[model samples]
Target: MSDVLQSAFNAFLEELKNSESLIRLTVSTLLLILVVAVSRFLLRRFIRRNIQSSEMRRRWLIQLRNILLIVLVLGLVVIWGHELRTFALSMVAIAVALVIATKELILCVSGALIKGGARSFNIGDRIQVKEFRGDVIDQNLLTTTILEVGPGRSMQQRSGRMVVLPNSLFASEAVINESYSQDFVLHTFSVPFLRQHEWRPAKQKLLELAQKHSEPYLEQAKRHFARLSYRTGLEQPVVEPRVTIQLQCAEELHLIVRLPTKEHDRNQTEQAILAELFADDDYLGDYLPRV
Candidate 1:
């Protein structure tokens, strides 16, 4: 067995020795390896001597390794340029197959590029992509990590869940940047009541509560929306507190309250309004559903 293996290896070497392209490839591979290895060694030595902090040294080493890898890849492409040209048709077919196999990965990268080029959202920006809505905690080429903001939008608070979404989703789904308004936003929430209840008084009370809670920031929000409209050429939206009535069904109705509040105070402001409205049932006593 040893003798047979030795003979096979010798024959393989002899065949390689005779082929000019094979010889060039072999020589180029060794030369590239030697250059990368030496460069890496020198880089490590310099970094270790000059960089005192362990974290800085680690970062430098990582960057150096990445540069060396890029150099090795470029070197191989340059050395195999002629051979690659000879197999251009085969390469094209292989490339197509690879693309099909890695379609999601390609989409993810393309999505990331599109997001960056468009400046769709940044870290800390609350965004809604289809059913998933959250604040972007981290983002990279393949995925985005968000602190999940809802079991549903009715609760404008984090659900303590971390959702990692493929960047590819950005390509297919519309990304709504909720934080685009910056400091102040016109937020809306629903207050459900029985259809038999007095919705008129409830509506008036809700408007009063919303207006009271939003009074401090109402002027600021108006100014912000004014600037936003001027810059974006969009018609300025109404920033005052308002209540719109809607019938959820024959038995139930909803009072949708639209109010301007600080971006981070949606839940708090809603809670405050509801708390005051339902505190003693005196304000909405007739409207409250009986147990």
Candidate 2:
């Protein structure tokens, strides 16, 4: 048994010395694997030390490490192609064809990966990509699902349609996440009426309604903005209800109320505002836009 082991060991050494391809393959594999392992370890340590409280950033870092490993492995295989030039060239040609055929798919997947890694937006967040505005309902490798929203009585209400947007669009288009850093979005609605000398009572009445309707949101927004300001170092905007009068036309005036509210509650809030306004005064109810 010892003699057999010795003979096997001798044969292994002889092969190691004579087989250039075997040596290259073994050394390259070990070295490349070590590099990958070290890189991952260092990256994880760095993330742990520097990145705090962001699960998305941690996920992104891990994904980037995996991608680095894949690219490194592929490049190493290509580098060791001298021993099997024909096979390597054939594989390369096939890869090129596949890339060409699935270029859009590749781009879409890449976009998804990038978007996910960046934590660009999450489910239930209101986002706009180009002209499409909606709450992101689902997201995967190829597409994002949204409940569509548009301008109407309530400027931010859902349009009762589902839009499946390809992830590829994220690569070329801009993304605006309304609830990215804050839980509430600033909402605006205008009540237009003819300008008259006796408009003070109506104007004061509208301002009271704006404050009453937005009271719940006002307190919540202040707490949210305080944290957001500290985190982002941005100047915090006042979270109280604001009523600004704008001249719409020579004969008309606009009372635009800006308030912070949850995007999901905007439709209901608009309806509530209208109901109260109509109940309080018959004149403005006739002129207000129909819900």
Candidate 3:
């Protein structure tokens, strides 16, 4: 009985020693698992320590961390126990297979990574990607979620349904990130003016109203623009609120008010300006342009 038990134990050890792939895969997996687990633990702790608000941004970061960890573990498994030549050949084969099997998916993921790494946009940013314009609510490996905006149900109201767009769209599409780098975007509202109404006074009044109503955003925009200018070696953008007058139809002028404010606050700002104008009723007087 003792001899049989010893023989069985010896045979088990011998199998383990001879199974090169199994041994290699097991060791590599264990090592990678440990490294990823420890690194992620540390990273999460650091993020919690530094980040003030634990919002959707933090959730996104956590998701990113998990993805990175998985990639790292898979990479280590591929590299371990394989000779350099073998690893290179394997990688080439895998790449070829991926191209053949999932070209579109690979493109989408690559585009998303590029967009995120380049800081082209972020969650909560108001952006127009191609024809879809909305506030970005969620961004993942393959797709981004947008809350639609525009005219009718498409324009003003936040569509309760979220739009999931492929990240690859950004590569071939023009992306306008309204809140990129800065919290405020320039919003322009145009009002028609009759030729009989004096344009200068209307412009002055519009400028004053914009400045008064958008004071907080104007100040914030100034600081944001200043920093961006210094970093990019561009002229500091003028954030002081103002209105421009344009002669349009022979019968009317266009009063264009440019205000610095959060993109999401555009409707509110427009309503406020109009309310103020209607309440005073003295700026344009009896010469108000036909609506």
Candidate 4:
């Protein structure tokens, strides 16, 4: 056992001689001891001269000693910073390799980070990504839950289904945040009709109906949009009602109506306009035909 101990001690001495980091650390420790001794001697002399009360002198001594210790520790850290950094980087690389082993989980985490960094959407905000459109109900690192909101964009009512989408999709897909405007938005819907020669009168009447329905909040929308434009440095968008004629095919015409309406009342406002337009025989019977 004594021979074994001697051999072990000899091995340790050999290692200590060869290890440059250990040698530097030992020298740095001795320097730190000298620095501490000098600092404490000066601190006691300064405190003795400045402080009148014994308790105050004691407190000063303690505080100065603590400061000296902290400085020594920080100096030691700075002296060995390169090694610490290398060790830290090695640990990080191992962690990254472990994370990449689970591809889906890493993707999900990456996507969550992307979403957070982008501030794309939040709880209760309506968003659309690819075929998925819904109000964000809950979100976690792995998945986002949305209360499904449509058979299509034209229909804005809830479908009473919950969709759990893997956050990974956000990395690949474009996200449309519908509630970004918060208060009001320009809502558009297509009104299809058979190709007719005299489409002007129907267009005029439809515009009039839209103007009537949206007249109540048109000024407010204009103000909001103006502020939004100023704050965002974007061009102020048209807030008034407008209609554009589009040729769906050789035999079909689509009258696209766009109007600014309150975000929450978008569907209701659109439904009201369509209901009124269809209920009137003059508007539907003479000009428009259902596709």
Q: Best lDDT goes to which candidate?
A: 1
Q: Which has the better lDDT: candidate 2, or candidate 4?
A: 4
Candidate 2 C-alpha lDDT tens digits along 1-291: 345445555655575568667866878878887888888888777878887878967786879788887878686767565545644454566667668878989989988987987788999898889888899999999999999888533466778999999999898888988776546767778877786533556567767887888786688778888888889899997778777889978998887877777767776776777688768555544456645
Better of 1 and 2 by TM-score: 1
Clashing pairs in 2: none
Superposed model 1: Cα runs more than 4 Å off? 1-86, 282-291
Give a tens-digit lDDT track for model 1, residues 1-291.
Answer: 345445555655575567678966978899999999999999899999999999999999999999999999999989877655645644565567668878999999989998898899999889999999999999999999999998887788999999999999988888999889888888899988886666678788899999899898778889999999999999999888999988988998899999999888888998999999878564345556667
**Residue 227 accuracy (lDDT) in model 4:** 94
Steric clash pairs (candidate 4): none
Best-fitting candidate, scored by TM-score: 1
Q: What is the per-residue lDDT of model 3 for residues 20-40, given as tens digits with 9 covering 90 to 100?
A: 676667777787777777877
Error of 4 at 210 (Å): 1.2
Relative to the true structure, candidate 3 has a C-alpha RMSD (angstroms) of 19.6
The model with the greater TM-score, 2 or 4, is 4
Q: Alpha-carbon error at 48 in model 1, in Å?
A: 65
Q: How close is candidate 1 to the true structure, as a TM-score?
A: 0.68
So what's the TM-score on candidate 4?
0.64
Per-candidate TM vs. native? 0.68, 0.60, 0.56, 0.64
